[model samples]
Target: MSATLGCFFLSMWLMRRRETVYGWFAVMSVAWWICGYNQVATSPWPFRSTDGWEIANTVSLLVYSASFTVFILRFCDGR
Candidate 1:
């Protein structure tokens, strides 16, 4: 669902590049999807150690948080 929403938002952004909120939302959604998938997946391939996986998860979380915050700020400010 998150990935779908991300693609939707990405398409929306592509349609209107001036509306950066949509771009940010797309980024946030994709990051959230990554985080969610990491949680559900049994193994984190391409990463040998748990530490690497943890780092990737943390980075995704940070991206989600930052993009969400920016999206909220831009969205609210536009109104």
Candidate 2:
């Protein structure tokens, strides 16, 4: 976990990404990775679980989904 966290922070620093919507895409991916890690750690047992981790993971995925959809539409359509 420490190594993962260290790599994440190091990558962020090395990236130095701008504050554009594209940057938000990277953020979304990172957020999803972290939240998904949490889900894996918790094992997501039982359908009765209603933790915030699930919500976060869902939201992060949604950001990526929407962004990728937009990218496909604009880039593919040449518009």
Candidate 3:
């Protein structure tokens, strides 16, 4: 939790620098944070025996994957 907050602050500071890579990295960090939260919230057995966790996990993974891919491409292409 503290780590996430630290990353958030770092991202904010980086944003002020007006760098494209930092912006993309911030976005990726946000996606990662969301995915981590979802996992923790649904871990150690769900409150209800449903597919909600599976669905949320899938969606989070997709978002994380897409953001990371974009970040890598943008960084590599010097966006």
Candidate 4:
């Protein structure tokens, strides 16, 4: 996760040079991922499953989905 976040921030920093909306979206995604991941960690699950990891996983998924959605929208707009 740290590596992933690190790469994303690196990309964002690069984007800052070009100054695209992707840079802002990256910031938003990172913020949401961090906040949601923490919430997931404190959540309770009843059964023993790899899915026992809820908070971080859910947050990660949502962040991925949101990022993908943005990518799609940008692609559709011929970005």
Candidate 5:
């Protein structure tokens, strides 16, 4: 959890610097926090299954992949 918070703040700082990659960092941090919240302590009152965390983790991966793909394309195109 602390690690996630650290990354989240780092990403925020990067975003403040206007780094495009930090957009993905921010998205992944949010997803990571959602996933991590499921395991650290008591479950929230509404959630019954771990499915939501799994989905959040999966979404994080997808966002990462999509961002990498876009970054690569832009780099190759000199954009």
Candidate 6:
């Protein structure tokens, strides 16, 4: 679902280049997807250890929060 939303928003941004909110929304969606996947995955295939996985997950969550805030602020014309 998050992937689909991210792709859809990305395509929307591509079609309407002037609307930057869509781009931010796409970023937020992709970050959310990464976080969600990290929560549900069985193993951390790419990471060498649990510490790396945790760090990556934490970074993704931070990205998700930042992007979501940006998306909301942009959508509301707050910036």
- Which candidate number would show the highest TM-score if scored against the true structure? 6
Off by over 4 Å in 6: none
Best by lDDT: 1
C-alpha displacement of 78 in model 6, angstroms?
A: 0.8
Task: Point out where model 3 deviates above 4 Å.
Answer: 1-14, 37-49
Q: lDDT per prediction?
A: 0.94, 0.55, 0.64, 0.59, 0.58, 0.93
How many clashes in each candidate?
0, 0, 0, 1, 0, 0
Q: How high is the lDDT of residue 43 in model 3?
A: 54
Worst 10 residues of 1 by lDDT: 37-46
lDDT per residue (tens digit) for residues 10-48 in model 3? 677576776455655666676667667764563535535
Q: Taking the tens digit of each residue's C-alpha lDDT, what string does model 1 give over 4-79?
A: 9999999999999999999999999999998998868788677998889999999999999999999999999853
Question: Tens digits of per-residue lDDT for model 4 on 1-79?
Answer: 6446646765976957564445545655664665555555544444355465655567667776766676566546744
Candidate 2, residues 1-79: lDDT per residue as tens digits?
A: 5335445654764577442334434444555565566645755544346675577668767875775565455445543
lDDT of 5 by residue, 1-79 (tens): 5456548756675757655555544554655555555566565445466676566557766775665566565446545
Better of 4 and 6 by lDDT: 6
Write down the worst ten-residue block by lDDT for model 6.
36-45
Residue 22 shift from truth in candidate 1, angstroms: 0.5
lDDT of 6 by residue, 1-79 (tens): 9999999999999999999999999999999998999868888879988889989889999999999999999999998
* Better by lDDT, candidate 3 or 2: 3
The local distance difference test score of model 2 is 0.55
> Which regions of candidate 1 deviate over 4 angstroms?
none
List TM-scores for all candidates, in order: 0.93, 0.41, 0.55, 0.39, 0.43, 0.94
List CA RMSD, all candidates. 1.6, 6.3, 4.2, 7.3, 4.7, 0.8
What alpha-carbon RMSD in Å does predicted model 2 have with respect to the real structure?
Answer: 6.3
